[model samples]
Target: MNEQLVLRVLGMDCAACEQRLAYAVRRVEGVRYAVADHGTGVLEVHLMPGTDREAVAARVVEAGFTVTGVETR
Candidate 1:
């Protein structure tokens, strides 16, 4: 089964921010897909096996965004 990570990210004020953050998240090794909505401040990622959720979150932080909450399913 696949895993999904839902995060509440902060400081994304525009579409460009969404693109930038989405790009960064997509670069993480086990990420299959990623989308960020600045309007909702929500970032959703589909991850494959061997993916570390924390690592994904770290990538988000490294991209100049703040991750305030996280959920998995």
Candidate 2:
């Protein structure tokens, strides 16, 4: 089964920002889905086994967002 990573990403206050962050995150290896909600500043990423959470967080930063919190399940 895939792992789900819930992240609190800042600066995604608009649809564009949300889309940009999702795009960047989806480019990361092992990510199956990257969904961001600007209203909630939440980014939910479902990834394959062995996917690196840090790498996904890095991509969020690269996309000009800040990850303030993270939880995995």
Candidate 3:
């Protein structure tokens, strides 16, 4: 099974921040796909089954973005 996660991000000031976050998420194992939008401060990620959402979020934070909220679908 696959799961989708969307995170509402904060403190992203420009496109570069968006790019960095996207890259970090993509680096996680089992991350099938990912996209980060600076305008919306949202990141949509598709993951394989059992993917750790918090770990993914941590990577985002480590990349220098604050995760304000998260939704899994």
Candidate 4:
């Protein structure tokens, strides 16, 4: 029951911003992997079953960015 979460992140201006956000997202519980692209302002995350989406978004925000939107698939 793993899931993929696609998030549109704001305020990402460079590769460093992407890396920081990706690292933060990966630290959240149940996150299997995360990748953030500065060019697209998107973060794609692979999460384990039952991962809390809000918590993930919060983590992204805490990492110094904004989560504009989220989609689960």
Highest TM-score scorer: 2
Residue 46 lDDT in model 4?
Answer: 97
Stretches off by above 4 angstroms in model 3 are none
Question: Pairs clashing in candidate 1?
Answer: none
| Whole-model lDDT per candidate | 0.95, 0.94, 0.91, 0.93
Backbone clash pairs for candidate 4 read none
C-alpha TM-scores of all predictions: 0.96, 0.97, 0.92, 0.96
Q: Kindly give the stretch of ten consecutive residues in candidate 4 with the minimal lDDT sum.
A: 60-69
Query: Quick one: ranking by TM-score, best first?
Result: 2, 1, 4, 3
- Expressed as tens digits, the lDDT of each residue in 1-73 for candidate 1 is 6799999999999999999999999999989999999999999999998799988999999999999999987
Q: Summarize candidate 2's per-residue lDDT along 1-73 as a digit string, tens digits.
A: 9999999988987999988999999999999999999999999999999998889999999889999999997
**Residue-level lDDT tens digits of model 3 in 1-73:** 8899999999777888878888889999999999998899999999999988888999988887789999999
The per-prediction CA RMSD against the true structure, in angstroms, equals 0.7, 0.5, 0.9, 0.7
Clash count list over all predictions: 0, 0, 0, 0
Misplaced by over 4 Å in model 1 are: none
Model 4 clash count equals 0
Between prediction 1 and prediction 2, the one with superior lDDT is 1
Model 2: per-residue Cα lDDT at residue 6: 97
Estimate, for each residue in 1-73, the C-alpha lDDT of model 4 and write its tens digit: 7899999999999999988999999999999999999999999999999989899999988998988899988
Model 2: lDDT to the true structure: 0.94
